[model samples]
Structure formats: structure tokens, C-alpha cells
Target: MIKFGLLWHKISLYASLLWHKISFCGIKFGLKLNISLLWKIWDYCNQATFNEVVYHQRTISSFLKVVFKEVDSNFAKLGTTNNSWFDYLILRRIGVETRAAPPPSMIEVHWWPPVGPWMKVNTDGSALGAPGSIAAGRVYRDHRGWVRGCFHFKRGLGFAFETELLAVIYVITIAHHKDWRHLWLEADLAYVVRLLNSHSLDIPWRFLASWKWTLRLLQDLRLQVSHIYREGNNVADLMVNRDCSEGWWPYALDEIKHAVALDMSTYSIIRIKY
Candidate 1:
């Protein structure tokens, strides 16, 4: 009896979701929705079990294809201006808003150089597998775009996040050794950026030591850690991809000068189309 009740509840929920989609698309596109068609769709959604959303998606899509073909009002063009009936249901299933695409300017990403005398250090970490060989890389560049320091260190047996934290700790150590007080650190990992910014003590036990060391280093240095798009962080990404032998020390900027120059010239004006 309990299983039967649960199945009925899910079927009702699916029917409700399907109805909402049809109504929303009809109102938004100024289309005359066929009530008979809407009922058929709801019935189909109701018959599909809770875990069969993907499997039944094809049937729903095929029904929409026939309905769209009969309407013959360029409802396909309405897709660009507003969400289609099928898309509306899919978006609701995935918990996304049904709205028109934002302007291109809204999605544009820019890579700005560090301001004033502050040094910008971009770091990234790569791993072949979760528990496989890991590597952390960082490229330190000044306001004038000169590479002050960079390195790719081999860290054996760790996950991606572990290597990212390792890179952060290692770079902070370099800054401390150089006694650089003003610095800006950038990484492609948003979670790591948030951890650094919040100075959160609640972290995995394995990274507790590195986390404490990072906090200690931050005490003496004026540092700003931020998250940047991977596109803006090609230099550090290159370092992450490189192979490093045992006891590999940081390389000077001159070694990766060619790649750095290319990234600098192309960093500005990242255009993203919706």
C-alpha cells in the first residue's frame, strides 16, 4: 500500500509539471494550446515511472514535433525569443528558469592585469586520476606582466582539490620567502578561492596542515585571492600540464616566455555567445 501511494504521488507531480510547462509556453508564445494535446501529454508523463524521465523524454519530444509541424507558425523561431514547450518542461525538471537569453555583454569575461605594484600569482593543479599522481603549478607575474617566479611541482597520490590546496600553500611560501607583502593570488577553482577568502577552519583532515600553514602566511602578507576563468589562467594551466621530475625547482619566467607572451596578447576581450 505504501509503495502504491508513493507511485501515485510521483505520477501526480509529473502531471503537474507537464501542465505547467504547456501553459507557460502557450502564454509566452501567444499560441492557442490544444487542450486535447495537453491532456495526452499529461497522461503519458503520468504513466512513466519516477526514474524514467530520460527514457520517456523521447516520446514527449516526438509528440511535440508533430504538434509543432501542424501549428506552422514558426514556433521554432519562438525558441530563440522564448522557451519552447518541450524545453520549458525540461528546464523545470532541472530547476532552471524559463527565460530569454541574456545579452552578450552579460556573459563577457575579461582578464585584467594586476593593478599598481601588486603581484598576481595564478595557480592551477592537475591529476591523472583522483588518487593518482598530482601536480600543482603557479605563475607569479608583476603589474608590468613580468614573470617573477613559476614552478610545477610533482605531488604524488592525491585528488584534484588536494593539489589545488597544495599549490596555494606552496605559492604562499614563496611569497613569504621573498618577503612580498602586497600580492594578488588567482586560481581557477572557485571552492579553493572561497576557502582562502573565508579562512574557514572546517576542512578535510588531510589538508589541515597545509590550511594552517596558509593562514599563518596570510598573517604577515597583504594578499587577495580570487577566482578566474580557465581562459584567463593559461600560463598556470600550462605549468599544471608539464611533467616534473623529482626535486624539480621553480623555473624563471624566461623559460616560459613564449607562452606567456601569447597569453598576454590574447587575454583581453573574451567574447562568449549564448
Candidate 2:
């Protein structure tokens, strides 16, 4: 009886979620994105949740401020708007009437595919030791989760940023070579994504020439870059841990094959946090 009651409760909750989804239209991220936000609203009901509301509002504002400020700083550094900086800002005016956003919540996440004509690349880079042996890896997949390609490279005596930045540059190079003009680049490093989106000149001087070339190539292609937490980037992370000195895999490696299959089946990996 208890289990039956719990099932019914979930059904009712989902029904409400569906209704709200149909009614709300602020963010176009779709049902999956809003699910956790709505779930967070009622996860722990009481004064504590209200307190969290205040905390999260401040956190979101600060995060947005920092990201925008960084971009603005980059714009100043470049002193030009013609460069590709991924200008993205959807400003919504807050009227006297408003909706309350809920605090954060744990959610299931998975490898999401790009729409048709757009290929995706998930990448990661790590150093054995800071300023030590560093390597990077990337996996290209289509909307059907078809393994388009897998590549990685090793470098001796370099900082982690070298691998991370190189990972981005290499993926762009691949896209151009393959004529995949529509590209979606995903990386585990938020900072790396920010650098690309900001078009910052703060990169290492050694890569400045290569970075400029990539930026120019970006103009000729439709490209997007995003950040995913390390967990969701399992395929690329696994690629980095292997000896890729042999170079491009004819197919997905055995270890990461299961993950690629799960993505093809639209499987979600659950994440729980305190």
C-alpha cells in the first residue's frame, strides 16, 4: 500500500509538472532542463528552502556578472567587435510581476546530441603533474551517437592549459579538415569554454598565432562551445587516460564503447549531491 501511494504521488507530481511546462515559456531549454528546476522547488519544503532561495539568487547574479565581466574585459583587450566572441545574451526585463526561481537540485544528465547538420565533440585534457606530461583527447559524434572519430595527442613538459587549449584548437582543425562547418564543441573545463566564448587574448603567447588562426577559421564555420561537468564527458575522459601515441582510433575504444552505446540509447547517468 505504501509503495502504491508513493507511485500515485509521483504521477500527480509529474502531471503538475506537465501543466506548468505547457504554461511557462521563459527559457527554451525544453522539458528536460526545467524538470530539475521544478523538482528543486519542493524537494525540501520549509524555511530552509526559502533561505536557499535567497542564497541561489545571489549566486546566479554573481556568476552571470563574472562571466559577462570577463567577456567585457576580453572585448576591451581585443578592442574590436568583429572577432567571434559568441555574443549571447537574452535580456529579460523584470516587471512588477515575476516568477520565483527555485534553488538548485540534483539531476540526471547524459550526453545530448546536436541537431541535424551539427556534429558534437566532447573533449578533456589533464596533466600527470602541473608543468609535467600533459595530454588531451576528443570524441566526435553525431545526433545518432555514431562515433565519427576519436583523437588525442601527448606533449612533454607543458602546463594543463596547454592540453586544454590545444584540445579546443585541435577539434576546430578537425572540423575544418572534415568540412564539418556546423560544430558543437564541449569540454569539461568551464574556463576553456569561457576563453573561447570570450575570445580572450589571455592565452599563452606561444599559442597566440594558432589561436588567431582558429578564430579566423571559426568565422567561416558555424561553431558553438559549451562546458559539461567531468562526469558527463566519460568518453573523452577515458580517451585521455589511454596511450594515444598510436593516434586516431579506427573505432571507439573498448573501454568507452559501453558509454557510447548508452548515449545512443539516450541513457541518463544519475547525479546526487548534498
Candidate 3:
């Protein structure tokens, strides 16, 4: 008996929503008659069940398209003088309204010393079908101690060192796109950082090739690459973890990482070793 009652309630609610959409369409299109009757129907529709509302999604979408066409036609006929029609109907649809005026304003100010530019890159890698993983993050800060950017990468493949090199490649690609002239690259991977800085001889030739390629692109710009501690690169670390766990596309992951790097590089220059 209770289930039957619930079913009946759902049916009634669906009927009300349907009626409301019809009435709203009619009124909006300037079907000028019995406005009070339509208002009552509209009120009842607003009070209907949530499930009924979801069920009417298709109907509502169609109704909106029709109403938009009507509005466009009205605008064409009336020109800019018909602004009030849009203000009244669209605002009501979204339930926004202006009411009270604001009081006289009070001003507050805070200031800090300007920081210079630096680009921090962090990277991590995770291997497929294996528990082994490697990750790295770097921060580049300007002379003023403001962080320019952060980068993180994860490699689950056994090629942790190669993944580190890839992260640098990603960073350089971002720098090239943004037209950065001078950048300080920091990473937590000592061997990779030393390789980039030309201070180590034991690193792989592939990594050397990537570094050379990055340098070729940055030949017009001033570039410095350094090493920092893993803990100092937490933000990039988090980003890498999120990407790995969520299985984000390489393009999307690069986009987000590059955006962070660019924003940081443009604003502040602070570098910290983790």
C-alpha cells in the first residue's frame, strides 16, 4: 500500500512539472491570456518532487530552446529597448535578485616586498605492473626568495632516471611556449640535476640528449638548473600523486604542470631545498 502511494505521488509530480513547462513556454512566447492561472501552475511546479524534476530534463531542455528562440525574435523586433524582458525572465530562471544597498566602504591594505622570478620543476614516475616507483619535485625561486614554479613527476617503470629527464623535457616545453627568457630549474634528483648542470659524467646519454635539446631551445634565454631535497617539493609531489592515482591523460597532466610552472615563474623567485 505504501509503495502504491509513493508511485501515485511520483505520477502527480511528473504531471505538475510537465504542466509548468508548458505554461512557462506559453507565457514567455507572449501567449497573452490567463496570467494568474499560469502563475498558480508555475508555483505548483516549483513545489514538485526532485525525482519528477530529473525525469523532466528532456522536456525542460526543449522548453528552454523554444523560449530562447522566442526571446531572440522579440529582441529583433524590439531592439535594445527590450532589455527588461531579459532581465526579468533570465534572472528569475536562475533565482538572482538585487535588494538592499551597501553601507559606506572601509579600506584595508597589506603589503609585502616584491620577490624575483624563478621556475621550479617537480617530476615523479610510476612503473606499470610493479610496486617500484620514483618521483621528484623541484622549486625555482628568484633572488628575492619568491617561488617561480613547482614541478612533480612519477614513474612506475624501472627507468626512474629517464622519467626525471622527461620531467625536464616537459618543463622546457612549457618554458618555450611561454617565451621565458631566464629560468632556474630545481629538482630533488641529485644525479639528474648534476647531469643537467654538467657536473656529473655517470648519467645516461639519453638524459644528456634531452638536456642538450632543452638547452638548445633555451639558448636565447638564461637558464640555471639545480638540485633540492624531496620534502621541499611537496606541491608538485601531490600533483604527481593525484595524476598517477586518477590516471590523468599525459596532455592534461602536462597542461596542469606547465600552468603551475609558468604562473610561478612569472610571479615570484624563491627556491627552497627539501
Candidate 4:
């Protein structure tokens, strides 16, 4: 009985070494193993070393089954050849071939509607090469998500942040001129949102003119300014990249209409399972 127990310990140790080698190989090629399973295997090996259980072919087979069951089937297929014992074991259990699960798709959150029946404007700006050439854009949508107006400008030379803040300034001025009292302004840039939200006057000297004017317009209106993710600001994004310097308003431009339609459709929620 003592000799059999000693031989079982050696076999378990050898099996552990093999698992370590195979797991390492899989990891080297970007395969992620089930960590909980790895821990269980480690614990079982440690217990086998300390326990007085006698060796048996059934016990060894059962141990292999437990370890293999924990492995990712797809990765297992990648690591072993058709003739490999692991492959043979998998084939016997599942029959035919079992493909790995597809990778999880990314979760995309799109434009959320504004609160209540208030007009909302989504604004964005782009600098072709940071400071090379600048363009600013804004898209207006009423409570029902109808395109009220849209505008774009070829503002000659400026930084990206400058263009972003300037775009908000233009939108607010337009809103004020039209006496659109209840307004919501949304932009993708965090700094631009912060400046408007805090009503800050401390801005770059060049932007001071537009900044002060925007504040004056804000004084009389029921206004709200917030930041949105870039994905949700697609219509404004399209306007900035368009060839026209102005008048994409009423969404008459076919390309702009198509983009807006697509953006509106993507507002639905998507759920992804791994």
C-alpha cells in the first residue's frame, strides 16, 4: 500500500507539470484560461500530495476529466493536434467539432433625448491637423427629435479646443437671436462643457470676445449645457466634416439627412453577451 501511494504521488506531480507547460503555451499565444479552474486544479494537486488515498486508474482518469472540463474548448482545439490525447478525449465527449464562442461585441450608447419639451443642440468642431484649418458645426433638434436647423463654418486658423468652444458660442448666439428660450446645449469636448456649465470667464485671450458675448446671451435664457460621448454627437460630427461652409439647416442636404437618419436609428440600446 505504501509503494502504491508513493507511485501515485509521482504520477500526480508529473500530471501537474504537464498542465503547467500546456497552460503556459496557451497564454503565450494570448489564450486566457479560466482562473477559478486553475486554482481548483492547484488545490486538488496539493491535496493529492498530502492525502493517503491509494493510486488507481479510475482516480487518475477522473482527475484528468476535471482539469480538461475547466479548459476553454476553443483554445484546447487550437493547442492540440487531432491525434493528441486531449483532442481524442474532447471528441469522444462532445462528438464532431465544437467551435469556440465568438468575441463579445462592444457596448455602444448613443444619443439620449433631452428632458421635457425643450430644444436641444448637439455641437462639435474639428481641426484638420490640430491647428492647420478649422471647422465648427451644430445640429438643432426639438423635443420630438426633429431637425430644427444645422450650421457649419470655415473658421480659418485655430486650435481644436478653441474651435470646440467657438462652436458652442455660435449655437448659443443663434439660439438667442431666434429667442429660443428653453435650450439644451450638448458637446463632446469636456473642457468646452465645463466652461459653459461653470459660466467661467477665465479662457484664452483670443476666445474672450466670443466667450463674453456667449455669457451675455446666456443671462436671459433657460439654458442647460452638458457633455456627451463622441458617438452620440454623430450628426454634429458629420456637419463639421462636410464640404459646405454653411446652410446644412432644415437638413435639406441629402448626405446630411442620411447621416441624421442613421444617427437617430442608432439611439436604440444594444446588449452584448460573452
Q: Scored by CA lDDT, what does every candidate get?
A: 0.68, 0.68, 0.48, 0.69
Candidate 2 overall lDDT versus native:
0.68
Q: Taking the tens digit of each residue's C-alpha lDDT, what string does model 2 give over 1-274?
A: 1233343354344334333423433244335434644464344233233443223343433433443343334333322221112211121211111123343468787888889889999999988887888988889998778889998788888888789998888889888988998999998787788888888878889999999998988897898888887778899988888864638775677878988887777678777653
Candidates, ranked, TM-score: 1, 2, 4, 3
Model 3, runs deviating above 4 Å = 1-114, 123-156, 199-202, 205-209, 243-274
TM-score per candidate: 0.60, 0.60, 0.38, 0.58
Instruction: Give lDDT tens digits, candidate 3, residues 119-149.
Output: 4344444344343565544433345544455
lDDT of 1: 0.68
Best by TM-score: 1
Stretch of 10 with least lDDT, candidate 1: 74-83
Q: Rank all candidate structures by their lDDT, best first, as comma-separated numbers.
A: 4, 2, 1, 3
Q: Which structure is stronger by lDDT: 1 or 3?
A: 1
Candidate 1, 1-274: lDDT as tens digits: 2243454454444445444444434463433445655566456545544545333444444555555443334343333323357656654554444444345553445556688778889889978896889988788888877777777788679889888888888888889998778989999898789888899887779879878988998999998988888877777887777655533344554446776786567545374654
Evaluated with lDDT, which candidate comes out highest?
4
Model 3, CA-based lDDT: 0.48
Q: Write down the worst ten-residue block by lDDT for model 3.
A: 106-115
For model 2, the stretches where C-alpha displacement exceeds 4 angstroms are 1-105
TM-score of 1: 0.60
